[model samples]
Target: MSSAYKTSAVENTSKYGPFTKMVDVYGLKILGLGNVGGQPQVSTEFLNKTAETFKLLLDPNAAGINKKSREKALKGLTSYNVIQRVGVKAHITHTRQALIAAKYRAGTKSMTSIDQEQTSSGICDLMGGPTLLLEQAQITENLEHALHTITQFALPAAFPQEMNISSKNGKASGISGDLYKALREAIANGVYDDSDYSRQR
Candidate 1:
């Protein structure tokens, strides 16, 4: 049996928080080993069984999942395919935004024209000024663009509930908050798909 399957079986047996932590540690070790070119030998049956166990753990309703069910409701979040998808989405979004910013900077003669073009192209709406800084960094060799890019990627993935906080309190926060909110909404609304990233190529 796969280590993942064994771990999942153990996880189902205990309600203790430390057990969960141990499972997480083991899972990470397994993932690390896989990354280091020593992938564990696991059967397809084992993997499928482990996935089913995970699905059961994630579902609030312990009732069996029907094969014909179109949508399965999950109680707890699972890392499953979400992390990979998010990573791809972020990469594609950043690269596309940077290319657009570079193209805009190259073609525009003035700051006003740059702003007009950015607004028209919706780059500003997607990434704010960080992408523009990335393009400027290419010409000026500035390290701040690297820092801005890091900050841009670190923004929260969920929408902010306090929309009026900025206007009501007169406190300025990071510029990426609105961008994160928009991105979250877009994801929830299915505005972008997995195949959307392929179009960038």
Candidate 2:
């Protein structure tokens, strides 16, 4: 019955097509007949404006380039895997916001001053916060530890085979042959540094 609830219901219906019935069992007219089963309409001019807005957001300095070229570049960038990663990060941020809201409502945790300040500043959404930072740092540390573990296991298994190949006619074999040849050439040319050898050992 609240304005907020009505607004949310309308928005939800707009996203998906409208429902079959306009009124619920309570005999209250929720949606008009015209709106029922109707898809949201988007204008071509509106789409063009949106594309221009995003182009400016992505590359503000692209003033010299024409609109079509800028749009083409923007399309290519959006098609890349980086856009998928951005979508994933956005989803995670939204999920965190929902969890924080639930915790605040349940009185389980106090909302931070930063969150209150952000809300007061007319920013209703809390995307990146301390939680996001902690998550990113934890992921980075885990990745570094995994890489270290993998290298530790791989090098001992690979070193003896490489040594055997290098000792035979000074020719390296297998997938690492090119890398081995480059290293030997660098050492022969006195370009290979041994300063880190002691540290590595």
Candidate 3:
């Protein structure tokens, strides 16, 4: 339910208390797609709906998901829902590009209507895209938010031993070692769900 990475993050093994730290959750990095993903600029109108990782939790036909995994994810909001910071660097000129512009990241402030928030998500979407459809862009925005829940919230909360990592300083233990390889292999073979979290020496 709670993120457990509470106030100020004081020590390697000591500080976190029991409150839901808004800062920790709020600052959680969601989506970070950029133009430099090496693909040429498409019409800013394209919404990559195929990467629907968020929709996985709402599967009515999720017979593959165990009961425990299903319950843990579908808890908050009576369902699910946003991304915070986004990197922006599109060269959308008004005459040629219609809506987007060449600039730094857009912040969530310059809105005159309930629908026109300043923030953007999933690449260059804050200023809308080539389709010129308001509703479509809004849907893309919401999808970015849901992306965070699966990656940072519910999955780690339900299966901490497997998903969460341990470390000192900055190097994460077992990340590139034998344990990491075993875990990677297990998931590839569809056996990760049955494997133990603890790594044996």
Candidate 4:
């Protein structure tokens, strides 16, 4: 996993696309760990493998490559894989925690801190957390690509609302009070995904 991410950084320097590099690094990391994660004794090995992979992805030197005419080719590759992996792990850990929570809900435990902590982690709550690993491995990286990747595939609910805001922004002041009002309404009504944009709101 570590070598895969390191090589991905080197390879992605010439491509200079965040979405593509994210998909590549993520796929490579997951694929490398897939077989190892299946074995009971090697479960911790898989986790360690992913951790080392993140370390290489976060390394400054390997990501500082310059293609004389291009932007920072390795820019988005940093932290993206690590954070995504963190999200995936949190999903797994919280799933187990949810079982613990359920037992508490069933009166198995006097307190529910384990389950409450599981509830606070966002990943496990998304679509019940079952599909989170696949989504993280597959669709999540496309967010940085063309909007169609998000609109048509990764996020459908966000696009129509985004179009609504965009249409209102064509006026004299651009993004008028009506747009703000609509945005606030959308946010208050919980129409957006829990993305960075949503957090900023």
Among the numbered candidates, top TM-score falls to 3
Off by over 4 Å in 3: 1-53, 57-60, 74-149, 166-169, 174-201
Candidate with best lDDT: 3
Q: lDDT ranking from best to worst?
A: 3, 4, 2, 1
Residue range 1-201, candidate 2, lDDT tens digits: 222112112211231122222211111112211111122222223223323323333342565745454343333322221110001221334434443443322112111111100101112222343444444443443344323322222222334344222233432333244446676679789998655664533
Candidate 1 weakest ten by summed lDDT: 110-119
| Clash count list over all predictions | 0, 0, 1, 0
Output the better candidate (2/3) by TM-score: 3
Candidate 3 residue pairs that clash: 82-145
Task: Give the least accurate 10-residue stretch of model 4, judged by summed lDDT.
Answer: 109-118
TM-score of 3: 0.30
Q: Is candidate 1 or candidate 2 better by lDDT?
A: 2
Over 133-193, each residue of candidate 4 has an lDDT whose tens digit, in order, gives 4335333322222222212221222233333323344553354344456766786799954
Q: How many Å off is the CA of 92 in candidate 2?
A: 9.4
* Candidate 1 local Cα displacement, residue 62, angstroms: 2.5
